[model samples]
Each structure stands twice: as C-alpha cells, then as structure tokens.
Target: MEVYLIRHTQVAVDKSICYGQSDVPLAETFARDALALEQKLKQQINDLHSAKILSSPALRCKQLAEYLGQEIEYHPDLLELNFGQWEMQAWKDLPPEEVNPWMEDFVHLRPPGGENFVELQARTARVFDALPQLEQSPVVIIAHAGVIRSMICKAIGLPLSNAFQIEIDYGSVSKLVCRWGLWNVKFLNL
Candidate 1:
C-alpha cells in the first residue's frame, strides 16, 4: 500500500498552546493553503483517477479534505490525541508542576480523563491496517500530525517513545510504501 499520510492545515489557535482534539476551527490561512495542498497532491499523484481519500472526522480535517472535490471516508481513528480536560489550554498556562510530569513521558501519559498513547496507537493501527493495495493506485489520508507520526513510527521501526522526534507539520505530507513485510518510508514529516 502506498499511503500518503497528511496532517491537517493549521487551526485558528495560539501557536504556543496545545490544541489536541479540541474541535478547534481551521485558520483563515487555510483557504490559500488548501489550494496549494491540492496542487501539491496533483504534482505527486499526477492523476487522481485511482486514488482513494480518507480523513479524520475532525471538522478541520473534513473541511480541508473537501478540496479534493471527491468522496472521502471519515475515520474516527484518524483524530488527534485526546487531551481530555486539557483541551484548549495553553501548555504554559497550565501548572507545570502538574503538567510537566505528563509531558515528560508523553507516549504513556494519559491526560486527565483521557486515553494514553497506547490507546491512540491501537486506534490508528486499525486505520493503518485497512490501507489498501497501493501498487494499483495511491491512498491519501487527511489526519492529525500525531496520527501521521504514529504511523511513521510503526512503519519505520521507530519506538513509540521516539515518535515525537518525527516532526510532522500541519498541511505536510508523509508517505510510506508497503511491499511484502517491508515498508519503505518515501517521505517523513514532509
């Protein structure tokens, strides 16, 4: 399978804050970024006749995926990390005395009333396993940075603890091609 893992465009939020799974709106800059994203995808795929599009159910992702002007599957598993009660709060604003411990061990740390990275990996794995054969075409997934990061870690043999070291930027594209038991990372954090 040739998976084009995509991170959704920027949201309208403070850059210094954490906005995980908070149902935030997309930034106004998205209109321009969407056009560029469309063009970028065209450059890579060249022809969309054989491409399959899937996306996170998050409103921001759905809104950006509309640029494809084609049918898209909404998969709940592709969502960003669930921050629970921490949603929408500036990381720095939160009591570091309380938040630092969790941030230090991000992969295993579950937010208050939320799931940990282990749970996230399981959910994303479901979506990852469903990826179809890509030799016949390409598969495009519009999801969160964390989703893309986790997939990359799984495909490239990186430990979950090191997943965050892979900086998947918003509106960026990451690619992996699977053949037999091996997955070739075509691009990372693109």
Candidate 2:
C-alpha cells in the first residue's frame, strides 16, 4: 500500500501561539502556496484520480484539502496534537518546567489539558491498522506536522522521544509504502 502524507499550510496564528488542534484561520496568501503544492502533487501523481485524499478535521487542513479538487474524507483521528489548555498560549506564558516535559518524555507527559504524543500515536496506530484493508490503493493524507511526525516514528520504529527528529513542513509531501508487514519509507518531510 502507498500512503502520501502532507502538512497543512500556515495559519494566521502568530508563531508565539501554540495551535495544535486549534481551529485557526489560514494565511491570506495561501492561494499561491496551495497552487504550488497542488501542482507538485499533480506531478507526483500522474493520474490524480488514482489517489484517495484524506485530511484532518481542522479548518486549516480542511481548506487546504479542498485545493486538491476532490472530496476529502475528514477524519477526527487526523487532528494535530491536542494541546489542551495550551492551545493558544505562548510558551513563555506557560508554567516554566511543564512546557518542555514533552520534549523529554513525550509519550507520558500530558499537556495541561491535552494529550502527549502517546495519545497521538495510539490514535495513529488505529488509523494505520485500518489502512491494510485498503491495500494497493494510494492514499493522500493531509494532516498536521505533529501527526506526520508521529506516523514517521511509528513507521520507522523510532522511540517516541525521537518524534522531534522528523521535520514536516506545511504543504510538504512524504510517501510510504507498506508491503508484507514491512514499511518502506519512500519519502519523509518532503
């Protein structure tokens, strides 16, 4: 099975604000980026109709998915890291030590009111399990940076703490092919 992953375009929220799972508006200049990304995907996928497109339920992701000119299957499981109470707060505004706990032990450290990568990975596992049933179908999953990172770690058997190692930028594409119970990472953070 072939899976194509891409992150959503930039949101209007300032960089100081944490926006995981937050429904923030996209940047006003998204048309250019969206068009470029769509063209890039078209180049990658000779027959765009051959790939099934899916996206996170977040507004940013939903809007970007529409640029593909197909009905995207919006899945709640595709949402970004649920930052809980830290959704819109700046790092400096958060408690001193708690802010970086996730960097140390991401799997167990839960954000004030949100979940850690552990929870994110668990949900991703469910999505991964279901993908096998759709073997031979190339699927395009437009999600968040964090979700894509988690999926990469899960695919490569990297420790959860290493999720930060993968760099998935907005509108970037990555490809994965799973065959015979083995995962082949064709592209990452493209």
Candidate 3:
C-alpha cells in the first residue's frame, strides 16, 4: 500500500499565533496553492477519484480534501497537536513559566488543558494502522504538519522528540510504502 501525506495550504493567521485544532482560515493564495498541489498529484495518480482520501476534520484540511475527491473520511485523530490554553495566542506572549518547560520537553509536557506530542502520535497511529486494510492503492491523507511528522515517526521508529527534524511545509506531500508489515519512506516534503 502507498500513502501520500499532504499538509494543508498556508493559513491566514499570524506567524506567532499558536493555532492547533483551531479552525483557521486559509491564505488568500489558497486557490493557487491547491491547484498546484493537485497538478503535482496528478502525475502520480491517474485518477484522484480512485484513491481513498482521509483528512483532518479541520476546515483547512477538509477544503483541500474536498477539492481532491468527493469521498473523503474525516478523522479527528488527524488533527494537529492541541495547544490548550495556548490556542490562538501569540507564542511570545505565553507565560515563560508554562512555555519554557514545554519547549524543553514537548513530547511529554501537556499544555495546560491540551495534550503532548506523544498523545498526538498515539491517536494518529490508530488511524494509520488501518490504512493497509483499505482496498486502495494510493491513500491520500490531508492533515497538519504535526500529524504528518507523527506518521513519519511511526513509520521509521523515530523518537517523537526528533519529529521536528522532519520538515513538513504547508501543502507538501510525503510518500511512504508499506510492505510485509514494514514501512519504507520514498520521499518527503515534495
């Protein structure tokens, strides 16, 4: 089975805003970005309609998935890391007492009322574990950068703390192939 992980297009929020699991608007260049991504995928997939589409329930991902295919499965587990009290707040404005510790060990530290990277990996893994069961060749998953990084970690046995090393940009696509119960990465951030 082949998996194509796609991050949503650029958002309209400020760069400093901590937005995770928040329904933010896409940038004004959404149409252009989405069209370019679609054309890129077409080179690999003969028919987008034949693939199994899965996406985060967030509006940004939903819109991209809808533009790709009509039959999409929205999963909450595909959401980005929850920021809790930090949601929609400027990262620089966050209390250093709270943000400093998390910055040191984001994998285990929970942000006030939200979960950590470990939690996000666990949930996304549950959904990823079922991908091989689907009767599809190329499985397209539209989600956030964090979710994409989590999947990469799960695929390669990489530690969650090092997930940031894998740069998944907005509207980027990464490919992975699962064979004999083992995952192999083909390319990333394409």
Candidate 4:
C-alpha cells in the first residue's frame, strides 16, 4: 500500500499563533495552492485519480480535500494535536515557564488541557493500522503538519522524540510504502 500524506495549505492565522486542532481557514491562495498540489500529485502518482482520499475534519484540511474533487472520508484521528488553552495564543507571548517544560519533553508533556505527542502518535497509529484493511492501492490523507509528521515517524521507525526532525511543510506531500508489514519512506516533504 502506498500512502500520500499531504499537509494543509497556508492558514489564515497570524504567524506566531498556536492553532492546533483549531478549525482555521485557508489563506487566499487556496485555489492556486490546491491547483499546484493537484498537478504535482498527478505527476508523482500514476493512479492518483483512483486513490482514496481521507482528511481531517478541520476546515484547513477539508477545503483542500474538497477542492481535489474526490469523495473524501473524514477521520477525527487525522486532527492536529490539540493545543487546548493554547489555541490561538501567540507562541512568542506564551510564558517560558508554561512552555519550557513541554519543550524539554514534548513527547510526554501535555499542555494545560491539551494532549501530548504520545496521544497524537497513538491516534495516528490507529489510522495507519486501519489503512491496509481500508484500501489496497494508493491512499491520500489531507491533514495537519503534526499528523503528517507522526505518520512519517511511524512509517520510518523513528522515535517520537525525533518527530520534529521530519519537517512537513504546508501543502507538501510525503509518500510511504508498506509491504507485508514492513514500511519504507518513498520521499519526504515533496
């Protein structure tokens, strides 16, 4: 099975805002970005037209999934990591005391009323576990950078602590292949 993990396009939020799991809107360049992404996918995947599309329920992801003109299935597991009270808060304005602990141990530390990376990893693992049963061919998942990075980590057998090492830029696509329970990364941040 081949999986195409796509991150959402630029969001409408301010640059420093922490908007995990928030239903943010896409930027004005959505149409242009979506078109470029669609063309890129067509060029990379031969059977893109027949691929199954799954997306997070967040508007940022749904907009692109809809724009792609495919029958998309929404999955809550695909949502970005919940930032809880930190939602919409400017990252630079957050107190160092409040943010430092999480920065020191992000994989295990949960924000005030938010989930940690371990929880995000668990949910994303479930999504990957179900993929083989859901489809035999290519599968495209439109989701957040966190979710895409989590998938990449799982596919490549990297530790959750190294999640940040895999950069999933907005509107970027990463490809993974699974064969008989073994996983391999086809490409990253394409």
**lDDT tens string, model 4, 55-139?**
9999898989998856888999999999888899999988889899999998999988999999999998898888889744789
lDDT of 4 at 168: 85
Which ten contiguous residues of candidate 2 have the minimum total lDDT?
128-137
lDDT of 3 by residue, 1-190 (tens): 9999999999999999999999999999999999999988898788989999999999999999999998999999999999999999999999999999998999999999999999999999999999989888899999999999999999999999999999999999899999999999999988
The better candidate by TM-score, 3 or 4, is 3
Model 3 TM: 0.98
After superposition, which runs of candidate 3 have C-alpha atoms over 4 Å from their true positions?
A: none
> Looking at model 4, which ten-residue stretch has the lowest summed lDDT?
128-137
Give the per-residue lDDT digits (tens) of candidate 2, residues 49-163. Answer: 6688878988899998888847678889989999898888997798868887666776789888899888998987778768778744788988998889888888879988877
**Highest lDDT: which candidate?**
3
Worst 10 residues of 3 by lDDT: 39-48
Provide the RMSD of all predictions against the true structure, rounded to 1 decimal: 1.7, 1.4, 0.7, 1.1
TM-score, every prediction: 0.93, 0.94, 0.98, 0.96
CA lDDT, candidate 3, residue 178:
97
Error of 1 at 181 (Å): 3.0
- Candidate with more favorable, higher TM-score: 2 or 4: 4
Off by over 4 Å in 2: none
Ranking by lDDT: 3, 4, 2, 1
1 versus 2: better TM-score goes to: 2
